[model samples]
Target chain A: MTNYHGQWLKLSPVAIIYFAVQFVKDVGNNLIYLLPAILVGYNQFSENGLVIISGLSALLLFVAISALLKFYFYQYRLTDGRVQIHSGVFQKNHIDLPFERIQNVRFEQPIFYRPTNHICMLLDTAGSSKLEAKIIALPKGVAESLKQEILSHKTEQVSNAENEQPEAEHEQILNSRSVQDLIIHGLASNRIWIVLGALAPFFNSLSEKFIAGIENLGVDVDALMASSQYAFWQYVLFFLSIAFIVIAFMALISVLGSVITFYDFKLTRSNDRYIRRNGFFTRHEVVMKLSRLQMIVYQQNWLDRVLQRVNLKFEQLGASLDRQSAGTSGGKIMVPSVTQGEANDLAADAWPENKLSAINYHPVSKRLAVRNTLIAFWLLIPLSGVLAYFGNGELAVASITLFILSTAFIILSWKRWGYAIDDNFIYLRKGLIGVNYRCFPIHKVQQTKLSQSWFMRRFKLCSVKLVLACGGQTLPFIKRTTGEKYIDTCLYQVEALRKSWM
Target chain B: MLADKFSNQSIKPDSLAKVSAQQFTPLSRAYVKVNLMCRLVFWLIVVSVLLVLYWQPWFPLPKMVALYLPQLQLAAGLFGLLSSTYGVIADKNKGYAIRQHDFSYRSGVIFKSVVSQPILRIQHVELKHGPVDRHFGLANLEIYSAGGSMHTFAIPGLPEEKARELRSYVLTHSDIAEND
Candidate 1:
């Protein structure tokens, strides 16, 4: 009677390394806040070399000892249809998780446990907004058996009408990213902007250090920059070359990051679940049940559009549902750099009746554009005039130019806003330079919100927000009649269908 | 048996009950007093905190407040009065209703909003009450769906017994819908 059956059990000794890695990861993620403390400690400890060395050793020893204690205290027992976990050295935690309550079960294999073939199993429950449980450093065979047991229990309890869907017992390859695809994804996605934004705080000191480094390398950087002999064209060429090098550097980093994170990325379908296997350093296997998937968001940035590739995000339940948090990194599976045909194929598989290729999209009311124009011109013109009156001619000119540019962009975005609802699914599309397509089953809608601002009410228009379990999507400035009609149909579907939207 | 009923049947959106047509049941009138009282208490605490910070030897706040004490007090008092008064007016527009297969809450004064959730989608419900709310015999019914961390909508100013009844009814209906 091992842990797999009726007896209590302990995690493998290798779990200490697992806990140690977790400690390092937490510290690294919080490095910004910890920087000041680290600097102060370093200043205080720098008086004596021996003290600093001993201080560092003491921290490491503490981490190691804590990890050991955590590993030793962790115990789990897998009984009939449930798993009871007893853990924690100080504040004890007891979790009795039933198989039916578990929404998802994913696995991770860190580099530390790779040699030993131990797995880290993460369980997510619908009741919790985050990962509810983690069973670290379990033998691969035991983990697999546990997963199967859970799956068996889950399948018996789902009660979804879609349970009769192609529950492929064998693994069927759905999608995979090639090395070229990964590279294209890196080049197309504006992940570099995010990295630069994070590093923006250090720019001033970084530039200073760079100049000093250049000086130390025997280059007369100041003199070269101060010289007036260089032609405008030559200076332009110098700046252009520097910009080119920087862009190339950013692209390199993006490509390396994409490769590392998406190495050997392969998505497979097995037993009504979409299994995603990826990661270079730490192999990750994420299993998303088909029935639990709320929606699929299809995105195309400028480069992605140019390359005729679309990135698809399969969204599930997440905590940040109310606010528009674009990149919260919750329950989602990202499939980047896929062809339109491939995207449609994936969409068709997820929701078979999805008309991704030939959706008859209806544009929003024209009053949206008129309203925006009125607001923009009435307010911006006066503001620009005030700036000019204050003798800031350049600022005024830029503001007017910006007004025109922004107006054009807004017009494009408004024109692209289209929505279509069929019997089963509803699709919403909006974009300025890049397109975003969101689609979900009509019945999967958790809630419907109709909002009318004072301006919108005057125009007989309303904003409709469809709140799904994954994330909410808002269709702004649509005719009130149309919005009501959509909501009515949506509600009718929800009432009539009674589909399990777990 | 459930699979047999699944179909791509055409639905007349016009025939279905329009969201705009549904009549909303307004909250208890006593809620306005409760709302005003809660805001008054909050503003009082804020004012007290500001006074403490300005008078106490915190080193930083005292000098700043000393220079603009009258202006700061006026601004806070004005904002508090305006906010509390607006809350009372807004509470008049707040209401909730349980329909055939869902629940709806209508709220806001200038910016009107109507939120509806399917009975089956509701994961849980709760009835909440503050001291002022209890004094007024008013309760807030919070309805949660299997979505975000936030409740779908929290309909406030319901009579206490009504709020409890709504919660229990919603929970029962949701369970039945789930098992249907």
Candidate 2:
């Protein structure tokens, strides 16, 4: 073996944008805050030359500070057996990671780091239980070689005596969904809201300008307002038209955005890991291992349930990316969309023998649903009456329409809420728009609670919630008497189980 | 079979040496002190709001006082007497035991919770001593599990020496690496 020492660098297009955006944001924020001071100091400037010198000095200082920070706190080294990082100027923190414990590794070069050939290496390890994410600006080939070395088989394992098991048969080298699947997923999604978002500004501007132009004309404003206020047909036509146009525009934008973002969405399986590569302009690569998965969630909304499709998300092993990663969908490895049977089959493939049971759960009956619908109707009646009065009965149609819609909503809400239990798993299927079939292993359930609210108690209904090590799942609005009995039995069984988990 | 035993053997070393039954000596007059503080704070807020709202020179003090007198007394009584009992009961119901092989805790009054952890799986053992607990010659033992966010479990009111011994015993007995 030779000691290969070289300066390595590579970056993605995303890195370039990220760096430029961050730099611009930092400068803009400071400049905005310092505007008053800068203006006040303007009078003290003797000449243009002095001002220019001062600006140049300040710019040089800023660049020097940034570069110094980068130089001092950005150390990375890849040895034969492990990766080493000694960073931070003040405290000098060090991280030593062995190759054997490394579960999954990924190379990302955001557009900002692209020009410098700097790549970010996110390493997931079995121990330390940390993501072990770091940025290593290395040559493309060297970065790839380091990843390969960590992933490569070793002769040392052969002599270890305990490493005699043959390689996994189902350890896939590469697997991905077709472009057709992505297209279907995007089309089926409820993304019509984006077009509305795009059109909102235009509509707002138009309305403001129209109102201003009318005011400028100086006609009898009060009489015109009174005429329109009493005109029932005009009011109905005007509001409805606006609503229809906005919804249509939103639908168009949402459809276009989805198509471009997930154009070639793909997920590949390699050895002990799964890699998800998606997004056209800003490509994102997420790598995760099988063992790190605490649980696999298959969910569907009402739309998905009716369409017989489910979404898969994996609960990974660690501190869960903190709050900042919430915008990135909580860092969960989502397998986008699949049919109900396909979702089950995929879970089975991931965890071979485990499958969900079909022990039908009794949901909150039609009686409760009707009661809820009546409550909603009564609550909205007063508001609707007030609106109807204000608009001279033009709004009466709106209230009647809402009352009619509530009937459908009440039935849908009740129908979507259900759960199933098996010897090894608990499955909760709920939601109206994007249905979710959440399954958790019985052994993984940390605790269970059966709660009754005043409204639910009156209707003889209760909610049962199960807490797990990774996350929580709830089966809401179950018949109180039956729900209590079911919870008691489950608790007893859980207590009796020989193995202990908490 | 040999490999299982080998791994298991490496995990549990001198298990009996670390096993102990601890009888926690409950906090004494600290309960009364806390109760008094709570009552004082509660009354302060109530009186301040009343004074601010009804600060009129024309109105007689007795009349204004009589209006809020019953509610104020009820709040004060509830704070003074009921809170200490709640705290005592909460403390009494929580107990845990640790051995070289494993640790188990029994908690909660209605919905009981019991957590048990094997020594080999523990990522690290922390001995924390706060000012209040230090004055009472008490230390809390925390055990962190691997790859889980809610991994840390704390058992309070252990003697400092015992906490140190437990930490050392676990370190020596468990084969798991302390990476974090």
lDDT of 2 by residue, B62-105 (tens): 77676986677667656645655565565566666654345665
Runs in model 1 deviating more than 4 A are: A1-4, A35-51, A129-131, A157-168, A218-222, A319-330, A373-383, B1-10, B37-85, B174-180
Candidate 1 pairs with clashing backbones = none
For A36-83, candidate 1 gives per-residue lDDT tens digits of: 466547756677889778978998998899999999899988888888
Q: What is the C-alpha lDDT of each candidate?
A: 0.83, 0.59
Best model per TM-score: 1
Tell me the deviation in Å of residue A50 in model 1. 4.6
TM-score values for chain B across all models: 0.80, 0.60
Candidate 2, residues A127-221: lDDT per residue as tens digits? 44333646545556666667666666432464364656545435353335556556556556666645446547567666666777788898655
How well does each candidate reproduce the native contacts, as fnat? Answer: 0.85, 0.03
Name the Cα RMSD for model 2: 9.0
